[model samples]
Target: MRCDNGPELISAALGEWCEVQVIVLHWIQLGKPTQNAYVERFNGSFRRKVLNAYLFATLRQVRHLLTE
Candidate 1:
């Protein structure tokens, strides 16, 4: 199981489906841009797909999107 610690919904469910190892990367450690390629790309994707779509109406909206 590999995921960004950002999503608690997914992080909270780690190791729940069969036997697996969870690797959560730190933000600074991840900034190196080489520890992981695909995961880093996906991180950019979520930021674009989910974050770019919404026109934030208030601070709460930005907070809400980050949580999801």
Candidate 2:
């Protein structure tokens, strides 16, 4: 999985879990979001469609809208 260089993601616990599972956690370099354009694009789309389009009152309401 490709991720930004976030502190929580770089934690020892997550590192150990990834190691045990042989999961390659590819990190994007700092200030280099262009390297992860596809994910960034999807995030923008989701935010525009689901987030900006509504005023969600609760988690269940958000889930119901998405499921519909």
Candidate 3:
């Protein structure tokens, strides 16, 4: 249940059911948005491109996809 200021990733029901701790990363304190540029790019790429394009049927598949 971790996100980067996105409501879509803030799934309360899923978090509660899985008992996961949510963590968010912000770049303001880093002086500039580019300070955490890699994470910023990863978030958009993961959310928009990869996540939308992939559909996993099981937790093992999901885990394998992520781990690899």
Candidate 4:
């Protein structure tokens, strides 16, 4: 999977899980958002479809809506 240099995605826990699953997690260079185009596109789609279409007062509510 290709992703940005976010702390959560670069954490040891996620690294361990990827190792266990034999998956390679590649991070794009800092300040280079275009390198992670797929994630950016998905995020844009998600924002348009879910975020912009709702008004959630809490993080939990957002998470719940996403899971749905």
Candidate 5:
């Protein structure tokens, strides 16, 4: 997984979980958003199209919409 040095991603808990799962994390350098441009673009689109367009009351509703 390629990700920025965000607190959540850098947490010890997550690191341990990844270690157990055998997933290698690739960290992008600070101040370099271009390295993760694809995910950034997708996040922007998801926020605009789905998140901003809806008022979800539950995880089930969000999952239902996402599946469609």
Candidate 6:
């Protein structure tokens, strides 16, 4: 998996899990968003379309909206 140096992705648990799963993680250079352009674009779209469009009262509501 290719990822950035975000704190969540840099956690020991995630690293151990990836190692056990035999998945190699490639970290892009810091401040280089172009390396992960597709995912970045998707994240921006998702934030705008779903996240910013609604206020959820519960997790189930979010899941339901996603399922639709």
Best by TM-score: 5
Worst 10 residues of 6 by lDDT: 3-12
Which run of 10 residues does model 5 get worst, by summed lDDT? 1-10
Task: Give the alpha carbon lDDT tens digit for every residue of 1-68 in model 3.
Answer: 22343455456675565555453333244335465567778877898876788887888887798888
Give the per-residue lDDT of model 1 (tens digit) for 1-62: 33443455344355453234445434424345555568779878988887677788799988
After superposing candidate 4 on the true structure, give the runs of residues whose Cα lies further than 4 Å from its correct spot: 55-68
Model 4 agreement with the true structure over 1-68: per-residue lDDT tens digits:
88888786878999899999999988889999999887789999999999899998999999898788
Cα lDDT of model 6 by residue, 2-64, tens digit? 998988789999899999999999999999989999988998999999999999999999999
Ranking by lDDT: 6, 5, 2, 4, 3, 1
Local error of candidate 3 at 38, Å?
Answer: 1.3
Best-fitting candidate, scored by lDDT = 6
lDDT digits (tens) for residues 18-47 of candidate 5: 999999999999999899999879988999
Error of 6 at 18 (Å): 0.7
Looking at model 2, report the run of 10 residues with the lowest lDDT sum: 1-10
Clashes of each: 0, 0, 0, 0, 0, 0
Each prediction's whole-model lDDT (CA): 0.59, 0.89, 0.60, 0.89, 0.92, 0.94
Tell me the spans in candidate 2 whose CA falls farther than 4 Å from its real position.
Answer: 6-22
What would the C-alpha RMSD of candidate 2 be, to one decimal place? 2.6
For candidate 2, write residues 9-60 as lDDT tens digits. 7888888889899999999999998999998899899999889999988999
- The TM-scores of all predictions, comma-separated, are 0.34, 0.67, 0.41, 0.69, 0.87, 0.85
RMSD of each: 7.9, 2.6, 6.1, 3.1, 1.2, 1.3
Per-residue lDDT value at 19 in model 2: 88
Off by over 4 Å in 6: none
In candidate 2, position 68 carries an lDDT of: 90
